[model samples]
Target chain A: MKFSELKKAVAIIGIALFVVVLSGCSGGDQDQEPGEGDQAVEEGLESAAGGETCASCHTDKKKLVADLDADPPQEVEKSEESEGEG
Target chain B: MEAEDKVLVAKEFLNTVHGQQGCTSCHGGVEPAASRKEAHQGMVAEPSAQKDSKCATCHADAAGTFEMTLHKTSRGIVDLDTGVLAARINPEKADLLQKAVDNHCASCHIDQCGDCHVSRPQWSGGGLIQGHVFQETPNPILNCTACHGSRVQKEMLGQGPSDFEPKLKPSVHWVPAGMQCVECHTKEWIHGPSTEAAVRYEVKEAPRCEDCHVDDTFYDNAYHKQHAEADPGKTLLQCQVCHSQPYNNCYGCHVGKDDKGLAYFKTDKSEFDFKIGRNPLKSQDRPYDYVVVRHVPVARDTFAFYGEDLLSNFDASPTWKYATPHNIVKVAPQAESCGSCHGNEAIFLLEENVAEDEREANREVIVPKPPPKF
Candidate 1:
């Protein structure tokens, strides 16, 4: 084969390799995002750590003590202004 | 002349003897004795000592029978040191016997015994000649025939011990075989310690059929159904009758219009029906034991009349009230109302379902491809 043809063949092979590597890398990245999306979906379905998280701040003992110390309101005070107005 | 003179002298001497001592008063024997004096001595001796034979002569029959009776034997044993004849006296019999002997011994010896002895008239109060008078206070004088005859005492008293022996009668009611009296009659007998037994044996306070039965599981089901049914005669409506299907998933409302061309509004009164599920504790698998739900409609407002619409409007915005754990009161929008069925967990996820997916999409979609701004 001629030397110039040999150069053209090597360039063609290099271009093919770059395209294959790019596609493979892109596919893996695309697959990872969907998995992350699935994880987020599952997490969203689960109840917010609302009650569970509050427990971390207010342990059983702390909650009991707070309950003991807290005075019950004598009557529900009428709102001077509606809180929900804002 | 000599004969006449002797006869006169003898007459004179006899007259003088009669005058001196009243004829044979001082003399002991008169005639039939070895001599005249011996006969007078027998006549003068104090009447020979009266023996017990005198009393026995009259009391022959009674003495004979009394000697044979257990009372006589007991008397002998009690007074063994006393003479044999003395042993005949039974203290228990003595009072009665002495009275009889004193009053009627002579009568008994004679044929007159039967007059008083045979079915004697019932005596009243105490009296002398009421021979062998039995004071029948509370107890009567019992004869041998009183207890001995085959049916004698039974007529006075009752049937024999065999009558008391328990015999099972054929049951009029259908009782399960081998069911003991104690099963239902728990306190019938004294079965335990004395105090416990006393408490148990009080028949008046003992449990009746209704005591364990009124609210028992077997009968209570029917009892409750009797009151609950709309038409009791038509249906033997039990809890299980209407609740044949176990769990129900409730839906808020219908989005589409019905044939009548009126929009349907879901109300707070809407409920899903449920039946008693299998007991969870009995299940082998824990996960499957969770309460299952199958959607069913309990109530629906089908008629779309103007009156119904007004009622719905009133229900939607009546004076607001606080919600209780047991009763929720609200007419939130349809989406918000889903919480009534799905609960808070699913309600929270509605927003997250769209939001979280959209955040990850990484490109915004504008309605159409926009030209780049100069």
Candidate 2:
């Protein structure tokens, strides 16, 4: 290969490597932003859930409706009788 | 008869005698009247324009002073239109001076002449004797002992020093100055409403020991300081210390063990040892032995710990996620968690008092382990 062409190819490769490293560093910065999912998980661990996890899901009307109507009476009755007057 | 009617009689008698003769003519009999009746008759027969003679018929000793007092010297007493006595005798005429004496003096004395005069030797005699007239005896001569008798007077006056005696004098300490019975006593009805009188005058409210000794707002800082300075180590000095009865001075509570484990609770110390069962659901079946616990030297950081079994059942774990060098139990709760038992402030103080070394020793004592199967 010609020496000039080899030097140009090597320069392109180095530029590409630098871009990858820069992106990797910025990726952690992106997670630090508020409203992100990872930040929410950190807050959840600090508060120890304390029933708030269940409350968050149960408070959603759609989810609550889905949970209530998902099972028919036959299935529910069977579970209740098996528990036996608990 | 109404006092007004009697005063009218007195006025008429005065007018009659004044129209005919001088004051000395009728009052001359005062010298010979050894009895009250004689003196009263002499006064009634010849009324005096000289107000002193009018009073002197009975209150002879008081007459000289009364003549000199503001009541007699001032025109306010005799001037029918403007005099206080005249108004009292005839209130419709706007004479306040007359009304004051008539309503105040005549109501009690009854006989107007007797209100002023004295005839009996025991009553008439004083230091103020002059020819045919008695002047006012000095206060020293007219002391309570004279009329009430020395023994009764001394008892009533209290075993106090005489007014003339110096307070700092060695002999005077035995007698306190002005400790007279009259200090608290008055001629007014003192025992309470007398059954004899249909309308009873309410007795005056007497001063309590606190009245003069304490200032207004005595509960405030200034007065309290004064009181403390005056009385060292005396109970009354630190009134608030006893009165406040501070409740924040102590800490105590209880803990209960259930099938799951143990939980702490704040409880009344008086009923500390009463067994409360492990499960709130089965409180009726009291199981574990009741232990009464109390924290000494109440501080801000006291705490109680729940057993592992109890924690597992309740799912209530302590706040500290990571174990410290002093805490052997993996999930040992912070002292603040026991606030239900030790109280918030007390728990804080207790935690503060626990030195690092002590905490380390305590941590060594507790070992985290799996529950042993029974």
Candidate 3:
């Protein structure tokens, strides 16, 4: 092939590679539509106290501690055989 | 959950095998999720909840056998074959009992891998225990004692829930030796190689008093010579019979939904008791003719709140079951003198002492009479 033709082929290959890289970076899962899980996530967010996101409050130590401490887990086995025993 | 701790967890996790794979691998949230809602979509809160979860993909040895393990199955509460539930309830009402279990006892059962290794048990107020890091051996106090505190913690460490009045004292080994659960309960036993165990004591690999006190000279003690070493036809006593302190005994646990529809369990109040009874689990492994027993929280109407006559065959098993209390000492109160226990009729579970409703049920375990003071 002629020098000019070789140069044109290389340019085409470079452009194709660039387009593929660009599409790969930004186009992942974008074509899929939101489903019920996404809807539930939205609903769950609406119900979250103060509309906090996973990161917004979880990352803040004081907020996380306060939220957890407010309704913390059971620390020890409640061994009372009945409803009201010490 | 400080911001720094969160960063540290992520940072440390990234360096580990699970962390190397990244969060989206097992957790199932969107990788490049732009918003909290997007990230939350398809996210699984406990990916290891299933018997064959991604955790099983790597820890196959443990995860596979875990299904049969005491900690995972809580067999005492729910197993069909060779379980306290099975021994009590009739076959026809098994399903109903299961529903009762789900509503009331399920919290006590291990539902996921993280329940033991990464987080505090859900029954003991569920949350991250050690920041979601997979620990080979969980912190005994935070994870094991959190659920077992009523008995094991109190007996072994001599402390229990704040409500445990008349606070107990530490066992001979737990405080002075500083021995952790794994020190005796080996990893093989904890993770499990699988066995047909109806109760924790049935696990063959479980720690034994003889395992540590193997010194032959130790048996020179008259009590040990007479009891620990087998003498045919004689009433061989378990070590706990002489060593264990009065441990918590709960009776008549009734479980059902409350008027407000929340699940609740009630009992006849617990007591610190130490009673020697005929061995309910008399097998080659446990040859003792007499052993320590504790009054479990079960009655004919224990599950009546769930359904009428749910446990129709409750009389099949004794309410006073075999126990290995942790409160052991070199010289226990009962061992102060032979007379302290030999003629101590109160320490022996007798017919007159049993509740009228439980007399027939406890016939096998109820001592006809205490041994004559020799």
Candidate 4:
């Protein structure tokens, strides 16, 4: 597979592992403090690529497209010709 | 940047040194935000614009004194217009010229650390080149040339063939040697020390030709043995006089407004030519009797659009200024034979070469006569 595809595959596997670990945590650690738990470390890792993080929208190429449904950045102005020299 | 909105970050970005901080660390936003807009509410596009930015928090030494550097302050350019030129003419209207400099000439130099390391300069279609990875060394093309493409880029890469000599090839350092700007212009030189040096030439740490080219490199050559010697009061030949190719020269600049009603500078003529003339910036450090000269894009009416008599005393300054062209080669046309340069008025900025209107301003730079046959 291409490098990008491989990365995507790894991301899918990581997501699967997070789901499995969260399921196991649901059964116990009810009294554990958030930061001290293995799940908290897992959550930290998840935050990097998680739905709530910058990576979520930024890494998703589909999030930005020229398609009709594509989302765009707000507050863009017509670019002016640059001025300045040495 | 038609797709300037598309910030498709890479998955591996989180593993980089800066990534570990999380997005909200440098770019402050409403974390666990009310909305996406709220999450980016306080996000700065180029954080390094501020002195004590996030980059400074970690890399304190460099960021601390960055503002004083010639690359940052561009104090020389501003100083010329508002200081020296003000004393020359229109001391009262320095305010308007200062305003013009701030809006136009100052834009390129206002660049910050991010403009070099993380993305292209803001003026040069800024965006992440490597998915927001922080480069230890700035990419020469993306960062350096983005602002300096006018001459340095063309000369260094030989992207521009010389008009004076159409057969001229790229710089030997670039075409065959494959040297990058960083090889000579080290990181320290680029970052600059904490000193408000008036000119880039004052930056002591900047590179010198002799620093790398040792004694033996020149001693073997007959031309080098005779003319390379420099002393306190004595003037020696500058390296570029023989080593560099004919480079670009700009003339007759007028600052005016376009259809959009925005202020801009337009050079009337940009030509490629080679000229040797007496050095005006001659000092102990640069005691060169004859050096390469290039016509700067300054005319009597340069600032006429702003107000009458703004640059009334423009003739006080030389239009043909000292230059160090970058298109260096092992053997140049001037180096072929002694006769090629001696008595060669074509290669010297003669009185006839000066434009009728600019002769007064360029009087010091115009060579009255050619050197006698060698």
**Estimated TM-score for each candidate:** 0.11, 0.18, 0.77, 0.82
Q: Which ten residues in a row have the lowest lDDT in candidate 1 chain B?
A: B320-329
- For A3-70, candidate 1 gives per-residue lDDT tens digits of 99999999999999999999999888787644244343333222253222211211234433444347
CAPRI-style docking class of model 1 based on DockQ: incorrect
Docking class of 3: incorrect
Q: Could you tell me how far off, in angstroms, the CA of residue B159 lies in candidate 1 after the best superposition?
A: 4.1
Q: Model 2's CAPRI class?
A: incorrect
User: How do the residues B1-374 of candidate 4 rate in per-residue lDDT, one tens digit apiece?
Assistant: 44533255655666666766777777676455434566578877677886578888888878876767778877767775433354345667777777666665666674688888877788776868687778888887888888888788877876554334456667887889878888888878777663745667666776778888856666777777767775454447888998988877887676766667665776676777889988877877777888899888767777777777777677887888888887899888877899988877789999888888878887887888777896
Q: Write the candidate numbers in order of decreasing TM-score.
A: 4, 3, 2, 1
Candidate 4 chain A, run of 10 with poorest lDDT:
A76-85
Q: Candidate 1: where is the Cα deviation over 4 Å?
A: A1-86, B1-55, B58-69, B75-142, B145-163, B166-374
If both were scored by DockQ, which would come out higher, candidate 2 or candidate 3?
3
* Residue B332 miss distance in model 1 (angstroms): 91
Error of 4 at B320 (Å): 1.1
After superposing candidate 3, which stretches have Cα over 4 Å from the reference? A1-86, B1-14, B160-167, B193-195
Per-residue error for B229 in candidate 4, Å, reads: 1.2
CAPRI classification of candidate 4: incorrect
Off by over 4 Å in 4: A1-51, A66-86, B1-6, B31-35, B80-89, B161-164, B193-196, B231-235
Number of the candidate with higher TM-score, 3 or 4? 4
> Distance (Å) between predicted and true CA of B28, model 2?
5.9
Q: Which portion of correct inter-chain contacts appears in model 3?
A: 0.11
**Against the true structure, whose lDDT is highest?**
3
- Model 3 agreement with the true structure over B1-374: per-residue lDDT tens digits: 33234322322333345544546577787544444557668988677786588888878988888777787777766676666677778778878888887777656777778877777766666566545567878788887888878788878888645565444568877878777788888878877944666777778788887888859697788777877888785668888998887898887787767555677777778878779999988988798989998998877887887678888887888889889898888777778898989888878898887899998888889998789888
